[model samples]
Target: MAKDSSFDIVSKVDMPEVTNAIQQAQRELEQRFDFKNSKSSIDLESDKIILVSDDDFKLSNVVDILESKLVKRGVSLRALDYGKVQPASGNTVKQEVKLVQGIAQDKSKLVIKAIKDSKIKVTASIQGDEIRVSGKNKDDLQAVIALLRKEDFGIELQFINFR
Candidate 1:
């Protein structure tokens, strides 16, 4: 009898790394020549990040710096969902950046469809925030991973729990 090879597909981020990135962004904002006296700030509240600055230009720069820090920390840019810039107190502008942490039901369906369309002789089932792929052949499981990697799901995907 052949045993099924399986793996889980997931999208997850390291919160500690995000914290470090935020701290680094704050330090840069303070030391930058243009940001001095600008009243620009960055705040991380649970799953969301708030960026505030005196104007559009400063706000844009702040976002750039924060994104760079996140990238350096190995956090994928695709995981960030940016909100519209709005006016804040004291004439400052603020933007909210939400950290997208999980694969939604809609996205899970898309992944399942992609796997089915690949004709790779494997089966995929949605498991909460992730998808489980299984097949009798290990080569088919690897092929599923490759196919998913080639498609842009607008979110970062990681394969784990291979067996």
Candidate 2:
């Protein structure tokens, strides 16, 4: 008998990197002239980020700055599921950016479908927010990974736990 080669596909974000990006964005918000009087602010909660600004224009600018900081910190923009800007108390606008940490059921189905459709000699199974792919040949596993990379799943996927 031979051991199966396998890898897990997961959508994970490094919280420390997110924290650093938020801190950098906050510093820029405090120092930037445009944001000085705009009263723009960013707050990171357990699984979401809160952005507050005086208006929609400033709110978008705040998001852009945060996104740039996040990119600099190697955080993919796809990890963020942004909410619509809504009016808050005192006429301020607030937007909630939710952090996506796992593969949803629909996405998992897509992954499985893609792998099966590709006719690759591999098996993919969903393992609670992650996909486990295994094959007798390591080359087949690598091909599956490459095939998945070429598809746009609307989220940042990471391949890990290879064995």
| Poorest 10 consecutive residues by lDDT, candidate 1 | 118-127
For model 2, what is the alpha-carbon lDDT of residue 157? 94
Return the top candidate by lDDT: 2
- The candidate maximizing TM-score is 2
Flag regions of model 2 displaced more than 4 Å.
none
**What is the per-residue lDDT of model 1 for residues 27-72, given as tens digits with 9 covering 90 to 100?**
9999999988899999999999999999999999999999999999
TM-score of candidate 2 on Cα atoms, chains taken together: 0.98
Clashing pairs in 1: none
